[model samples]
Target: MRIAKVEAFWLRCPIPEAKQHRSDYGLLTAFDMTLVVITTESGLQGFGEAKAAVGSSGVCASIVSCVENELAPILIGQDARNINELWERMYNGVRDHYAIKRGRVFPILGNRGLTVSAMSGVDMALWDILGKSLNVPVVQLLGGAIRDRMEAYASGGWAGADAIGEQLLGYTAKGFKAIKMRVGVMDETVDYSIERVKAAREALGPDIKIMADAHGTFSVPEAKRFCRGVEDCNLYWMEEPISPDNKKGTAEVRAMTTIPIAAGESEFTRFNIRELIELSAVDVIQPDSAIMGGITESWRVAALAAAYQLELAPHCWGSALSFMAGVNIAFASPSAVVIEFSSGGNPMMYDLVEEQIQAVDGQILAPTDPGLGMTVNWDFVKEYKQ
Candidate 1:
């Protein structure tokens, strides 16, 4: 069918007090998400989310501007079935050009912040439309379910050492077998992270998995120190120990540490993913489906990961729409190790959707319904719309 309407809603969803978290970045503050709704000529509505982590300004407006002015005009009457073609059109439409220094050519697209974020929403909506039209779940369209249920890891917990006792107990109490906690927020030293992991391991025992996220906080040397120091903790992986773009630094950290490196949440497209893999930067790929041109590009990244023998544990940190998109990607890809479940302490996690994503005893059942397999609570979403 043909595309008829494309709309974007930007919302600033505040973190609930009970679920409030802190990290290296700062207090786990309000999150910004841009929801894209696409209405086909036949009146089918498909929803997608953009990973809209806003600054003081410009970001939310950019998301809306791109969809309304740049992309919608280009794809208004185009066939929604040509998902890839439309994706390329949108990807190529945005070009950052200037600095033409005597024969130097630079026409970049499908890379970086607002360009990819906006394109991601549109690309995702196309997949949702495609799935709804065919009456098949998005997972089926991707290649069918690879596993019966997805294993999810609880993410958060960087309040402090004093809070570790409470945090660890809370996670296990929810029956989460694996958990990831924030490090490097308190101090610039490795001592804090080492202690945090040690405490987590001590509380968790051997069977439960522990992962650490430095949030791209340390230098290469500091990362090496932290990873080696926490080696005894038997962490599942060390995430974003160094900056996301430092391929050489990441590779060096990976070489020195026995712990697996997981990154790419800050990365925007498959190109970024390719460079990371070619450099052997990470053991696991963490493509944020909402940010990286949606499920279509993430699936492409997953295929790339398979070729490199890498595991996909997608970086999930947004509304339920984005979370479910990540889940569907995990379901479809054989290389998936785990899909992050950030719903533990956040009501916004479940409030964004009408259907609940039930995770019992650390396992999540894959949704089998049509489209993205989750219904958006637009009314709730509208309440916080900017």
Candidate 2:
């Protein structure tokens, strides 16, 4: 089948009960998802979503434009069944040819990174098409699943100490064995943050696993102090204590704390992750399926982390589409420990998809449908077209 048409949709779903903490400065905004659809001449269609970062729809738009204009022509008559070959052809188009024009001239500006994200959306859609044609789920295409279900953790956005404690109990009661707490609201004192962690540990008791995220809000000294205070809280891990750019700072924090450090949500490709892993910067790897070069590069990142014996816990705070994409990676991955689920928005997540993935007794059921398996809500598509 030859190429027919490609379309891009940017959707902004509402967040009910938006709340903010002193640590986070940005608005606790609603769910915003960027959807990409590819149609083949034989009538088969594939769907993909890119996790739009804060105000990057325009970048995603450029990504789709490049796919439609530059890449689609090259693959018009190629067999879609050769998913790996197609992925290599598309990726090498940018890395081998485009990189010399972009990366060499203005390496600091990062145009190739943008191209990688765009290519990621297109590459994932191709895999979806391949899976559908073969009548198998994406997991099976990715060498079958390692587990039937993934254990999940509950996280609250802009939640206060009391609210977080109560939320932790709710998840605990629901049988969640682990939970993640959001921190680093640019606070100097960090006393309130420590108290929140202490309270969560107390409420959940000793057996439960707790992880803390600074969200790139803390400096080296600041993160050290904050992590030190909760040293005995029995945290499962600490995430993004410093900004992704400050490699030296991240390494310093990694060395200072005994708590396992995790990052890579902001990281894009295998090269970026290789630097982090080489420096011994983080104990865990968290790559967002929508953001970190989609499935192709993400699988490479998982393999890279496994070679280092590092854990993979992807940063997931997008629509059910992005979450399910992460779920597929988690299912096939052996190093992945837990998947993150947000308590930040209501109908925000539920309204964005046709059906929620089954989360029974704290574990998410593996999707059995061919490809990504979730239906795209076209009405929501029309509603949030930007």
Candidate 3:
């Protein structure tokens, strides 16, 4: 069968409390989720969501435009079963051919950011279609799950110390042993970040794991200092302490501190992930399904990380669709230690799916049904559609 119609929906979901969702990047005024639906000739629908960075309206718009104007024109009429060909088409269309024209001296500035986000959504929807065509779970189609039930870290640690204390208590009470918190949002100072880490450690105690995310705000020296300061907290891992672009700087920070550095949620291809692995920039690889070309490319990343013996904690920040996509990857990979479970800030996450996955006794039970198991709540979709 052929892929017929490709639709993109932009939903600007608001955060519950305005002050609660602010991060190092900026305040998450409203979350923008771009959903992709690929309809086959037989009338089966496959759904996907783009996990754009918080407060990125332009990027979100770019994703919708890329899918509608760029990707759909090329993807529509293509064989629905030929997933590899479709991915390669999107990849080259964005990153290769369109990027470098004859007289052009340089490639496009933000093609990786804008073009790939759109491509990723399409890729996910295509995979969902593929899984549904053959009656099997996406993880099974990927050679079955290495893990039946996956463990997850509570994805919070926002606001300040007092909020963090309460949040951590709530997460642990819900049986989350590992949690991630924002570090560089409030204060750029190493001392302030350290205090946050210290407070988190004190609240969660030494047994529970605390992972701090700088969100790529700090410079090399500042990131190093912050890592060193929080080294005493015995964190499980530190995520994106510096920018993802600075490979040398990331490696230097890794050399300076014992905390395991994690990054690559912003990166979209296996080439970038391979570079991160080869450079020893990140100890744990966090590739987001929605942003990293969905299941196909994310599985490639998982293989790459496995070859290097690096940990894979699939970065999840979008709707339930993308979270389930991440879960499929987490289930299929032996090296996957934990997947991100959102808390507090993301309203779209809670409202997007029929049944949201939750942790029980510190482990999340992944979806075992056919496709990515994404049963979208279309009522919420219509209500929040931008």
Candidate 4:
């Protein structure tokens, strides 16, 4: 089927005051995303999400504009099933012929940032359309699932030392066996971040798997010190301890600490992930489908993780479309053992879709429904679209 139309809407849903939490990204007041819809000539439609930021809040106008003014024009009359060729066309711009002829990238100047983000949404929608056309789930299109279900970790913890344990236990009460907490600048000091993690470990005992995400706020030395202090806690992994800009510094911290380093949610494409792997900076690769180059690129990252013997835990902190996209990748990749479940007040994750995405006793079953396995809540989109 040929692509008939492409539309993008910027959706921003304000978080309820009681559900909000503070972190290195500051107190998140709203959740925002760019929703992309691709309709085929035969009346089939697919949905995808493009993110402006890794965190909960961002200005999505630019992403919407990029999809409408730039990417959509290139895609309107193309064959909807030509997903890979379309991706290269969007990336290579006018030089797509060269890339196709040479079997390598001849990317445009906008290869990395906003253009990639827009491409991510379009690529996801294309996958959704392909799966629908074949009457199969997205995971099946990715060579079927390796497991029936996958373990998930609660991905929100912002409480201070005094209340951190209780906050984490709340997630466990919901049957999550693993949990992640925020650290770094949010705590105001590296030592305080250490104390909070220690307290969480003490309260949860050794059975519960704990992870700490610094949101790329700490310096190299500070990350090293925090790792040193929490060495005894047996953290599942330490995530984004330093900025994404410093691959060497992240490698240095990883070398100094026994804690496995995890990163890549802030990155753009497989090329960025390739650098992280080459530098030996991370033990786990966490590609967010919405921010990185969508399912097409995330699957590539998962393959890299498998080849390199690294772990794959896709970052799933955005809308349900992105979260389900990550789940599909996780289920299909042998390297992916666990997926992320947001524990914060994320409206986009819950209210953006008609499906109820929840963990059952800390495990998520593989999706059997067609496409991304979610029905868009157009009413919700109408109310929230900015």
Candidate 5:
């Protein structure tokens, strides 16, 4: 079916004060995401989500404009099933013909950042459309699932040292066997971060897996020190210890510490992930489908992870659309053993779609519904559209 229309809306939902948590990105007050909808000529519609930032809160006006004013014109009237070709067209811009002819990228100047983010949304929607047309789930389109279900780790922990253990215990109470906690600048000191992790480990015991994320706030030395201090804790992985800009520094920290380094949620495309792999900087590659060129590119990243013997734990911290997109990738990729379940106060995660996402007994089942397996709650979208 041909694409008949493309539209984007910026949605913002405030977090209740009681559920809000502090992090290196500061206290998140609201959650924002760009919702993209693609309608086919035959009346079928698909949904996708794009992000302006890796965190929960971001101004989505630019993403919306990029999707509506910039990319939509290129997408309308194209064959909705030509997902990859459309992605190449969006990325290569006017030079799409040359890129297609040569079987290589002739990307435009806006190959990254907002342009890619916009492209991500459109790509996801196109995949959703393709899956629905075939009457199969997105994971099946990606070659079916590798397993019936995968483990899900709780992805929020921001309590201080005194309460960190209790906070982590709360996640375990929800049947999550693995949990991730925030570290780095949020703690104000490396020692405090170390103390908090140690406390969490002690409280959760050795059987439960624990992960720590610095949110790219720590320097190389600080990351090394924190790793050294928490070496005995058996962390599942240490995530984004240093900035995404410093691949060498991340590699250095990974080399110095036994803790497995995880990164890539802040990155754009498979190319960025290729660099991280080449540098040996990360043991786990976390590609957020919303930010990392959608399911098309994220599947590529998962393949790279599999070929390189690295782990795949897609960053699932946005709307239900992005989260399910990640889940589809995780199920399709053999490298992915665990998926992320946001344990924060994210309205977009729960209320943005009609479908409910839940991790049962710390495991997430493979989605059986066609497309991304979610229906947009238009009423919620109308109320939250900014």
Candidate 6:
């Protein structure tokens, strides 16, 4: 079958007030999602999502327009089965001389990041289509899964130290052996960050693992001091201690702290990952499925990380769509330590996905269905569609 048409929908769904979390990118407020639907000649279609900002329904519209008006024509008559080749062609088609030079500007694609995000949506849909066509799950296409489940780190403690401590204990009580908390937002005080990590350690006890994310909000000195201060906490990893693109900053942080440095969510493509890995910039690699070229590219990132003996723990920050996509990658990954749950405390996640992804005690069960396993609630999709 050949790709016939591609359509994108910008959906803005109103989230319940009670369900809003501090980190709910848009859950409490109306949030926008760019959903891409690729139709084939035989009438089979697959769905995917792009990383749209909250209330950026128009951005989603523009992305869909780019795919339908610009990229779809390039693929309409092409064989739908050559997923990888098609992905390369799509990449090269837009990675014009300008994108090659400025890195932000592309000749065919006006914005590089948006173009990558849009392309990721399309690539994910193509994989979904291919998996559905083969009557197999995406993991099967990626050589089957190695593990039955992934360990989950309770990803958020946003309510403050006490609240976060309670959350960590909740995960521990539930049997999770590890949890990750957002740092660097704590007044930029190493003392404050250290106290937060210490509080989590105190609440969870010694055996449980704790990780912290600086969220690219730390200055080099603060990160260095914070990493050193928390060295005794035995943090599983210190994530994005500095900006993702600041290789020097990350390297300095990595050198200063015995704690493992984790990064890569903001990064795109295998090229960035290769450089990060080669430089040993971070101890763990965090490639997000939605932001890092979807599954096609993240799998490559995982592979490259494996080659370098680095850990792969995806940075999950979007809706359930992106979360499930991350699950597929983790399922097939050998070096992945834990899949991050946006402990952002948002209900859009629980609302958008029919299958609730709760960690039983501490580990997440692998999705058993084909493609991304979990099905999207289109009714919810419709409600949220802008």
Q: Provide the lDDT at 72 for model 5.
A: 88
Show the lowest summed lDDT stretch of 10 residues, model 3. 98-107
Residue 111 deviation, candidate 5, in Å? 1.1
Q: Which stretches of candidate 4 lie over 4 Å from their true place?
A: none
Tell me the number of clashing residue pairs for each predicted model. Answer: 1, 1, 0, 0, 0, 11
State the RMSD for candidate 4.
0.7
| Model 5 steric clash total | 0
lDDT of 4 by residue, 1-386 (tens): 99999999999999999999988778888999999999999999999999999999999999999999999999999999999889889999999999999999999998888789889999999999999889899999999999999999998889989999999999999999999999999999999999999999999999999999999999999999999999999999999999999999999999998999999999999999999999999999999899788899999999999999999999999999999999999999999999999989988889899999989999999989999988899999999989
Clashes of 6: 11
- Pairs that collide, model 4: none
Candidate 5 clashing pairs?
none
lDDT of 2 by residue, 263-365 (tens): 9988877778998988889999988766777788788898988899999887777666567677888889899868887655534356656876556777887
RMSD of each: 4.0, 3.6, 3.5, 0.7, 0.7, 3.9
| lDDT of candidates 1 onward, in order | 0.79, 0.73, 0.80, 0.94, 0.94, 0.74
Off by over 4 Å in 1: 54-59, 94-110, 343-348
TM-scores of all candidate predictions against the true structure? 0.93, 0.88, 0.92, 0.99, 0.99, 0.89
lDDT of 3 by residue, 1-386 (tens): 79899999988876666425666556666667899999988999899877566323324776788789988988898887788777766766554443344423233343467677777888888888888888788888888888668778888777576667887888889888888888874675778888878988888788998899888888898888888788789988988888877988898889889999999887867878888877888899988888887788899999998889999998887677888898988888888978888876666677788876667888977567888887788898898887
- lDDT for model 4 comes to 0.94
Tens digits of lDDT, candidate 5, 300-351: 9999999999999999989999999999999999999999999999899899
For residue 202, give model 1's deviation from the true position in Å: 0.6
Q: Which candidate do you rate higher for TM-score, 2 or 5?
A: 5
- The residue pairs in collision within model 2 are 23-185
